[model samples]
Target: MSSSSQEPQLPVIAVVGPTGSGKSDLGVNLALALNGEVINADALQFYRGMDIGTAKITVEERKGVPHHLLDTMDVTQEASVADFQKDCRAAILDIHSRGKRAILVGGSGLYVRAALDVLEFPGTDPKLRKQLEEECESKGLAPLRARLEELDPVSAARLGDARRVIRALEVHGLTGRPFSSFMPQREYFQPALQIGLEVDREQLRERLALRVHGMVDAGLREEVRGLDAIGLRRGKTASRALGYAQFLRVLDGGMSADAAVEETIVATRQFARRQLTWFRGDPRITWIDWQDPELVPKAVQAVNAASPASA
Candidate 1:
């Protein structure tokens, strides 16, 4: 007796958590169990040749489950949330058309939100951005940041760093709207079930530190050196990636590998804290202990019991 319009909207299965929490593995498992494909939501994974630092899954580890959106960009190209939203939705639609589920995976907060929530991106003006950057350089960030404070206090408070502040100013200049006004609503753009991996704080800390050391031992410095030769320094997004930045200093002879290792570990831990805070603020996500031995079976159960999505 129900109309077609009342049918459940297609669902997106998202696995999200702090870094080093096994999101990628869970994603692969969920995809295989559900006859699905994973669509990476991690921003850093988009760049090609960023394997070592990103801890990207090897081909063999993927178990032949097709992953979309990884290695889609050169190191030099900027990662854009807007572009990701468009591309992720397209991937979801394409997968659904084939009667396959789409598993969204990553810990990138805003990027994950962009792919799931109702968010509007303000248009950008390159000239205005350049003007703002020039002003920041010539006049210093204080005046421009102060200007943004007056025009968009919300965004001014939330945004940090020169690049972000300037981008906020540029957004206001172009749209005549505060950048914060475009914040994502919690409403889902389609049916979705978010799975969060919960881990012990101390345990995760140890894991992250060991993980960094493993990357270093796996030739992270060599990776950085090769990437630097290829102009990684000119890559805004890739250049600033977690471990890559610390190692860049090592390559510059300004730091020792040991020093960079410690610094990268600290920075990565901080980044993980920030990620945890961001994802924890959303009540829509269902959390599971990362150590659960029955994780895959429970995830499959969640998907099956979820009231959204057809086949």
Candidate 2:
């Protein structure tokens, strides 16, 4: 065999889309059809006992296909995309070495990109970060967000919270460049295929509402109650997760259970819109209708077409 033929064709597939878009089930189907194992890129799914809120696939749901990187962190631990990039890359490599396809699955846009793109994260300075945090505390996020908008309108427009706004400011303070400038370009670090799932906006809104109601019925409040015992509120990242955050308000008597569920549904719909915007900006993705019955087959075909041998 020629040297090119002798080299292994490692499969790196990423299934990405909005919440309630059937990404997890599609990923599992792809894995089963393509001899692949899953590496989670969902930031929320990394926390242990965060099952109900994050919609993490249960053991029975995974259907014997091995999954990596799920439930690996405590609720009190901060989840870092940089750290996830390292861990996910290692997991992908290990899966390839074992002669299996590697499936990267999640709705976390940056996390998925960090796994497959030639992206570099700037180093953090503790003192600077602390100063920025203090500033946010003493003054307000308004000043920081305004500054970010002036410096990097793109990032400012996308980031909605104070913590992330502060981090962007910290990046600018440290690097002397707009945080938007550090955004990943359209370059892949590995040979990979990205599949995106999309749904009609009205249908998606309805689906999200139903899903949130289902989660509440499935004991999401109880899940949060359990995590509260483990100091979930102390975790910078985990505490801010969509469903968890809303339910925490309910648990604190700041909101009613019914109100919490409604709020989570709205927040999730907005989040899904953001996710769709992020993924749609990337032209490399092969988008499929989420409700298509032939979704798995179409995804499999896309994967095969992406393989070098098929080229």
For residues 1-311, what per-residue lDDT tens digits would candidate 2 score against the true structure? 37645685765899999988888898899989988999999999999999998889999999999999999999999999899999999999889877789999999999999999999998798999999899989998899999999998999999999988988999999999888888898899988899999789999999889989999899999999999999999999999998899989999999999888888888899999999999999999999999888999999999988886733
Candidate no. 1 TM-score: 0.93
Model 1 local distance difference test score: 0.93
Count clashing residue pairs per candidate.
Answer: 0, 0
Measured over all alpha carbons after superposition, the RMSD of each candidate to the real structure, in angstroms, is 2.4, 3.2
lDDT, residue 161, model 1: 99
Worst 10 residues of 2 by lDDT: 1-10
TM-score of each: 0.93, 0.88
